[model samples]
Target chain A: GESVGLHLPTLSVQEGDNSIINCAYSNSASDYFIWYKQESGKGPQFIIDIRSNMDKRQGQRVTVLLNKTVKHLSLQIAATQPGDSAVYFCAENRDGATNKLIFGTGTLLAVQP
Target chain B: EAGVTQFPSHSVIEKGQTVTLRCDPISGHDNLYWYRRVMGKEIKFLLHFVKESKQDESGMPNNRFLAERTGGTYSTLKVQPAELEDSGVYFCASSQLTGSNTEAFFGQGTRLTVV
Candidate 1:
């Protein structure tokens, strides 16, 4: 049950290499973006987040880049590892709206050793 | 502090039958939400509850889906006369703040299968 879902755009990378996953959002009013990782049989777990004010934010081994002009978001992982193999999702939320997250179809990151 | 918790990790039911899924949010979280991913689709919002009142239900698909947070402590989603399209993974999440995109804690989703 460690598989989020079988149907997702997959990115295969060698262990120790950098991995990048991208997403496109439609809402122009969305002021915050968050990235999540979902393993099999589990819910989406929060990874990192960035507000609309900042173009980039860095966390422990993770970086989130946001481009409000183009409404694009990307997550970069420093090193690919077996444990990092999971479905990654990007979610957006607009200010003054219900605090519900609008999620994108996830990308599965597969680490190849 | 315990994270969000969901009941019945998995369920299989016949079409037109009834299924109820429950979720318990973190002790002090005031905002609770429900989302689901059907088949190969992305997770979509279902509803949101603030305290005992439903803050927003615009994402509810149809009348057959009913959600309630009786005491503002726990919530339940009831799918009556469920259809094949109702089959999906139901996830519950809770956050401490509203109007802000703070991190939401998610529970292990409940996978519902309709045959």
Candidate 2:
């Protein structure tokens, strides 16, 4: 079975510093990728997404970088804040799979003020 | 301007019991999906609905799980005679359309605990 995994299970960063979370996926056929933020006892919230054709996409304060050559994906957060403390997950969607998303084992981000 | 919403944020039932989780997607969104994550695992897809019809259900775990999207408004996932393995967090998501590039909005999720 194909799987998506994160390089780190936990990350701690100081406020105002940059944070990076990495993911590796097994399926080369996946064409769409997304990043989601999940707080405790809550559902995952959409952050940003990038297509396989592009290398990077930016949102309000988040950026998603995709390296197809290595099947690696990363979510970079600029000027991290306390509100940014949450679990981040990277999801991949296969080309033919319309609405199915395969999520990675999440990285827990802890922002220290 | 509401996002996806789910009902019964938490559920605890004994084995062999039945539980139903509900989801209300964003207004006028035509795509709906179901996903779940068991303890210490990643989130996995369950099924998808396009409008009022089931577009894909290959991710459904077994026949004991049933999903319905009547009127294409709200969707429900019913687990009958649930087993201990069914304990997990079930999430529902929706998108404006069904495409390879569309971003999906997720609900708060329903956490089920089977005793």
Candidate 3:
């Protein structure tokens, strides 16, 4: 079955440093991708998203880069904070399949202050 | 505005028992979705509702699980004769039918433990 997966299970970083989480998806028909952050005891929250037509999209402190050639995507958070510690999941929106977001296994980001 | 909200933050039920989880999506949002994450696994989609009609339920695990969204408002998921494998965090989300903002708003989730 075609699925989305994360490159790392966990990543640790200093509070002031930048953090990057990677994901690879197998479904070639997917046209949209999103990044979600889930803290303990909470559901996944929307972080950022990118469309296939674009290569990069930037949010407040976050940036999403899409590499269609490699079927890869990444989320970069600048000046990571302790509050940024959470599990980050990359999801692809399968349009033909009802536009449901297919999520990766997620990468746990631990930011130490 | 209020975001997606799920009822019963936690539940612990014995095997063979039945449990029902609820979700109330944001007002006027016609799209609702149910997803669950078993321990150590990725969040998997269970079903999706477009208003009162079910758009897709291909992700449903089995006949033991049933979901309904009556009146195109709140939705419910009932697990009958629950098994230990049914234990997990059930999350509900909502979004618009079509728009540039394709992001889905998620609830805190209901933690179900089948003991």
Off by over 4 Å in 3: A1-8, B99-101
Ranking 1 against 2 by DockQ, winner: 1
Please give, for residues B1-107, the per-residue lDDT of candidate 3 as tens digits: 98899999999999999999999999999999999988748889889999999998989999999999999999999999899999888999998764444778999
Q: Is candidate 1 or candidate 3 better by DockQ?
A: 1
Best by DockQ: 1
> What's the count of clashing pairs in each model shown?
2, 0, 0
**DockQ of each two-chain model:** 0.66, 0.48, 0.40
Per-residue lDDT for A72-111 in model 3, tens only? 9999999999999989999888863466878999999999
* Model 1 spans with C-alpha error above 4 angstroms: A1-6
Put the candidates in lDDT order, highest first.
1, 2, 3
The digit string of per-residue lDDT tens for model 2 on A8-78 reads: 48899999999999999989989999899999778898898889999999888889999999999999999
Name every residue pair that clashes in candidate 3: none
Candidate 3 chain B minimal-lDDT segment of 10 residues: B95-104
Ranked by DockQ from best down, the candidates are 1, 2, 3
